[model samples]
Target: MHPVEDHGAPGSGGSRSAAGWLVLLALAGLAAFLLARPILTGPVAGLPAVAQSSSPYTVHRPAGGVRGGGIVNVDTELGYRGTLAAGTGIILDRDGLVLTNNHVIQGATALKATDTRTGRTFPAHVVGYDRSNDVAVIRLSGAKGAGLRPAAFGDSGKVSEGDAVTAKGNAGGKGGAPKIAQGRVTALEQTVIARDDSDGSSERLSGLIETDAAIRPGDSGGPLFNASGEVVGMDTAASAGFKMAKKGKGRGFAIPINRALGIAEQIRQGHGGAKIHIGRTAMLGVQVRPVDAGRTGSGGQSADGGQSGGQGGGQGGGAEVASTLPDTPADRLDVPTGAVITALDGEPVDSPNTLTDLLLRHHPGDRVALTYRMPGGQPVTQQITLASGPPQ
Candidate 1:
């Protein structure tokens, strides 16, 4: 979903001023046009551009004979926030059903998919999302030409450490042609926390296939192929650096193709499982801003000389409540604006994203405990049932 950091730009919650909105717009432009495409930006016009550095992998070869008809370049618009996000997808059926990471299409208003083989683009739409599994499905009803080529799937169960593999995607977010990177299966049944450094949202992922392949930004949801050219996994996340690489070679992660296809089948059949959010997001109905830096445990005092509530025993940083949706969980719990959220379910709230990341672990209709305090007051804890959120 990213190069070194996640896609999209970090969003601020505290203020709703016009200038704030403008800043967000600028960030959106930078993310979509600059970062997404890996192109030069302001003050660099007419300058010679440099090529991407080689992957830090060895014992690899070009994926020349690998089939790429099923790979698609995925792009989505974060509607309300005016940002564009990019990733990759694999065609699952002749009718253009696509499988991708949930984060790829989340909060999307407009979706466009580009076929790797034909270079044809199609308007795509979300079918469903499994936030817990970080998987999603989209349909491309209007794809041009003779439809799509479904990828041949292999048994992920057959994968073993040291197995040969190749990865493909729209590396660098360039949608024209998918890039190829080769490596070997380094581990299996891996568990990780896939994080979005931009927005601070993170997902706990498990049962993953780990590889030393060079997965890049815009590669999320792309295919990981075995030596026989069959899809064995779906490229998902990559480590920022290789702990074992003296030169810092990084590793990549993927969802087993078997697991990915199972979820896709359920989504196509309209199965709304307990962990799946169909066409909606699970939300707590509160807007918050990150606590200012250099503040003590009490978040100090508000700039207006008003009390800002105690910081309590939360982590490094915490979120200051800006507002709560009327009739929602936070409002029902009487979580007043300006209160600082210190913890959730006993876990410290280090930042706005930390709260968001933790809340995403639960689904709609789930109940969570929150700890907070009003300005200059002691901490208070309450149990609140989350509600289905509006489409972003």
Candidate 2:
């Protein structure tokens, strides 16, 4: 199970169509879903390069060598299998504040960014994130005096269909100057259900701008600029199995810049809500799955030597621990693999999602009471401390 949230644009229809999977434009060797249990896999090699532009629209590198622009190449070290992922970001302030998609840094253990303008790399930290909206803000260390340039933002509400647009980013995760793909806005207020290829979990993103621009992997969170070179949207998901903009082919989606900025502002002010998480995530360091009805008790038998059911022996609804990470709080406290977590700090944890939500209300070093039940046994409560984990 994974943490899930409900979010949609105002006045947008409440219907979610089961469209085909929309690939998130983040460059990584293997597909990994946000908030899912980690699985080690072999590295995938030889990602294809972005298609060359043949349309009349321009594809040249930006003038002044990226130092004049507000984009940066973001690299993240994942918590699993030495995996590295790359994406793009837009500078929001001279102090290295950046706006990006939450999925770009979802499972990051460590993050670093390179300023295209000066070619300087700096360590970065997440300021806050709204996973429901797929928006995040990160601040670059040692960038206070670097004189970073901020991207010019335009009113997304004023944008009209058929308006000329250009999407720019690290096209192939090649990590240098940003690449540009020019096209026109084909639609607005579009909604799409994006599914994670790794886990089959789906999210509905509403009020997006649709374009034919050749937005590809490694372009996630890059700026979608209008004809005036002002950002009107943030490049996000793209249609799969389409060639890159040959004769105006392929489809891309972008979150409106105005809406993204609004989320960023809330993060900057340290405001947290049901959907917004401020600062680092607290980790229980355990992999879990929903408890199955059949195997709910000790040795697959109830206390009365019968199948476990309502009040027979097993906890009715809770997350079953599959495994615990070594040296983490869960392992340190000897949380049994076959036990079901029934509560956290006296609050009932009915499922994996409930457990995740309860943990989000805490921080590192906070000691809390954990309650779990062994197979066919009474609930046991233990005190444990939480540790800091990678971005969720």
- Please name the candidate that would achieve the greatest TM-score relative to the true structure: 2
Instruction: State each candidate's clash count.
Output: 2, 1
Model 2 Cα lDDT, one tens digit per residue, 1-392: 11212143321221121211111101111243222212122112332222111222121121232222699899876543234567889998888889998877776778888988789999999998877677899999999989777887767777777899999887666789999889998877776666545433455676778788878777888899988888888888776543433657777888888778888888888888887889888888776655665553764533211111133123576666767777888888888877877788888776555666677777788899988887656678999888887656
Q: What would the per-residue lDDT of candidate 1 be over residues 277-382, giving only the tens digit for each residue?
A: 4554456767776665545445454422112222434433457677775677887888887777778788777555456556655667888788876766567889
* Every model's TM-score: 0.62, 0.76
Error of 1 at 301 (Å): 14
Per-model lDDT: 0.63, 0.68
Cα RMSDs, all models: 11.3, 12.2
The TM-score between candidate 2 and the true structure equals 0.76
Which structure among the candidates has the greatest lDDT?
2
